[model samples]
Target: MRSTGMRARSVPHDSRPVHARPRETEYRPRHPLDLARVVLPQRHGAGDPTMAAANGVIWRASRTPDGPATLALRAGAGGHVRAAAWGPGAEWALDQLPALCGADDDPTGFDAGAHPLVAEAHRRHPDLRIGRTDLVFDALVSAIIEQKVTGMQAFGAWRRIVAWYGERAPGPTPKPMFAPPTIEGWRRVPSWAWHRAGLEPPQSRTIVEAARRGDAIVRAAASAPDADGRERIFTSLRGVGVWTSAETRIRAFGDPDAVSVGDYHLAHHVGFVLTGSRVDDDGMLELLAPWAGQRQRVIRLLYASGIQEPRRGPRMHPEDHRDR
Candidate 1:
């Protein structure tokens, strides 16, 4: 049977001084860090059960290699990120905090001078970095949920699924959050549950199939030598395509070159920003060819430049599959 919502009560806070010592840590990155940019983009919706950001702090929940964990990150003085964790996977989450906050990202060799617009954007937000999450499965599942659907529909479905199946995050976060389901948990979700969440057969089936081989997928991504190699592993999965693979790599691996070539609005956005006219995917690629290894960075700069293509036609309507 499909669960309508989670019934679990919030875990009580521990009072023991030493054993219940707050599981907290901190990291100071060499590069300037923007807490909101690194974490907020990963949120699927305003009500995303896996994440919450408020009062300059970001809280996240995940099923890590060790177990379920909840993490809170706040920006502190002198480019430092203060973090706290709870649950069995607390240590693992803390250990991975540097990468999650983009400590490993190197913007060297990226010449913002290649384009006037890009240069202006880089001048405005030089601290921009592509953050990475070591949890590839989480990114993959979220990307799959957004496939060929309006943002409203996709976010609604994602929130429903997580609220129904995900476990409550530990610690006293401002808002209640849930850890995303583990791979085995995703495999166990029935078709009826997916339907209730407004997910169609194609996306739900793809997520289940991907979960079945989740371990192998994670290993392949970890072992791959380069962005291209990692992307190949992701695209090999059934129903996974170039756009989905790029989206996953951007979040999971932080591949700066991974452009969403097939995205409906990206090409137009790129074209309008660079050439003052709209272009198709092919044209966008041609214009961006000079920056072969940093295409995604270029797109990011274009977005930061505050240039947008004029809206035309009606917005895509959210589709509800439960009534069908």
Candidate 2:
């Protein structure tokens, strides 16, 4: 059993005046079912090895198939989750943790086993777990929100929707957790409402279209082979494409093989990392040639290994379509 405590505080940033409640809980993932051991150390941040820091709103408190297990994140001071949940859909969440952590990844497809880079990554992180949030609705909604917006903008919109429409998870979770939007809730969003959501007409249309056929999409994506299958299905729609589908599959099904195609920055990142300079679609394909079937795994391993290209160009400014 977990414990709770409350304390009030004042904040200058939040305009909505409300009482603050600081909750704390002692989580003991049943022995022999040790979660800390299953917990993949955070490989993408700058921090103490023992603690996982926030990577934005993607981190939130969640429950798993097992009793009250925390998904892909670390608990914060006030008991907030630094990551999102991977609900119980499959054993892949934990069973495939090793591969996700670069432990069992085979990047020979990415090279002739001649490249020492991917091999080194696996050596560094042996227990990394890929998040498995099986809730299709949540993944789809987030994907729609992220269609054409910046990460910050998309996350902000997600926070608003969750705060307004989602429910708190039943447990000792610190931050507010919400269930995915229902079909009815999605249909009720007015055109004006989407404007306030910081979304454009194209993205909004895609979301509505998907929502209307949401059930079909979920079933198809779930039953498909992997990221590639999911992409094939998602792109069949008028609006969904390679990037959106890849993003969805990575978290929705925890498919280790879903690589985002046509990303504004991914090809460049891949190029710099592998060939010491930026690359285009062709170069990226060449670099990832060995890992064609498991390209996504290589990407995940690279991301987890903490190697990055140096920043030089200007950043993508967030477009607040709400103001247009």
Candidate 3:
């Protein structure tokens, strides 16, 4: 029911407090429109909060009107926000609403005509949309946090950073919203803090070094011709290998072809999914040879197929360097 009533609400994503914003007040499209649908591949480590089924397509939050800390986003044409959900940092979330919907995927390079996997996946699940994420900031932080550590270790570190430095989400739901640490914040993290985050010296040093030169790296990426070029420039830094660079690119530019070649888990997952056998990096590459330019897309499809890795051992435990 579309309402022309006055109401107030907070916004989502941003950590700041909420204010007021004028919205459609009802769930009516500005124009008659149908739902926009697209197919997506299931894969490990490709989670985006916007795509999370629990959040739904229409996100509502309250804050200010112009760059409000909170906002409501409806999926489809003439996307009209309904009501205000209030909070802080709503503007940041709203600012990224379009990117959250995966608006930047270049159809020319990734269309089904060239990549059969994408075509097949689309055929299988017509509602999946392949959207490109804005990776510029998150990629750098994730890459730094992930340097030379187990997944559990890295995730723990990332959580700590967010909890300490991030703000509350401005949505109706009180979610822990985070602002990716600024370049200044990155430089200020002490050595002891890294140790407490369960990061070893190598990973810590790499991040610090990267942080010191972060501006240059960002500039390089901004000026590059494509994601591949950005990866190449990022890799030129010390301690950044093929795996690290590729992993970062996956988030930053949403490079569809950026297959994580050197990851500890990816090759094994690919092997198990594709060949029903565990394989090394070389084996994984060989198996994916058929997909060539769309290697990442193939990996995404295999993952979306809902295949799981057969476990033969115990999981890694979380270690807190803070205790030491």
Which prediction has the highest lDDT against the true structure? 1
Query: Model 1's lDDT to the true fold?
Result: 0.82
Instruction: Candidate 1: give the clashing pairs.
Output: none
Clashes of each: 0, 9, 37
lDDT of 1 by residue, 1-324 (tens): 844574322233233312234489989888877778777777888888888888878989888899878888999999799998988889999998888887777788898888898899988887787778889998999888888887777898888788667776677767667787888878878888788788878999999999999999999998999998987898889889888898899988888888887777788889999999999879999989888898888887888788887878778663322111
Any idea how many clashes model 3 has? Answer: 37
* TM-score: model 2 vs. ground truth: 0.66
CA lDDT of each prediction against the hidden true structure? 0.82, 0.53, 0.54
lDDT digits (tens) for residues 1-324 of candidate 2: 522231111111222323223222233221122133223322112221112324422233322234222334453444223333343311333443333223333334344254577768656654333445565655666677776567666666665554444333332233444433465456556666567656677777777787888778778887988665777887788777777777777666666567666666778788877777898767887888777666776676677667788777888674332211
What shift in Å separates residue 304 of candidate 1 from its native position after superposition?
1.7
* N/CA/C clash count, model 1: 0
Per-residue lDDT of 1-324 in model 3, one digit per residue for the tens?
A: 843252211113344555455323333332322223321221112232222222444332211223224344445335543334344444445454443344444434544433444457645653332433344545666666675567666777765554444434345443433334555556667676667667777767777788788777777886899867887887787777777777777665666678776676788898887667899889988977766766776676666667787678887653322111
Error of 2 at 102 (Å): 11
Preferred candidate (lDDT higher): 1 or 3: 1
Give the TM-score ranking, best first: 1, 3, 2
Q: What is the lDDT of candidate 3?
A: 0.54
For each candidate, what TM-score against the reference?
0.90, 0.66, 0.70
Give the Å error, residue 212, model 1: 1.3
Error of 1 at 218 (Å): 0.9
Error of 3 at 78 (Å): 12
lDDT of 3 at 183: 59
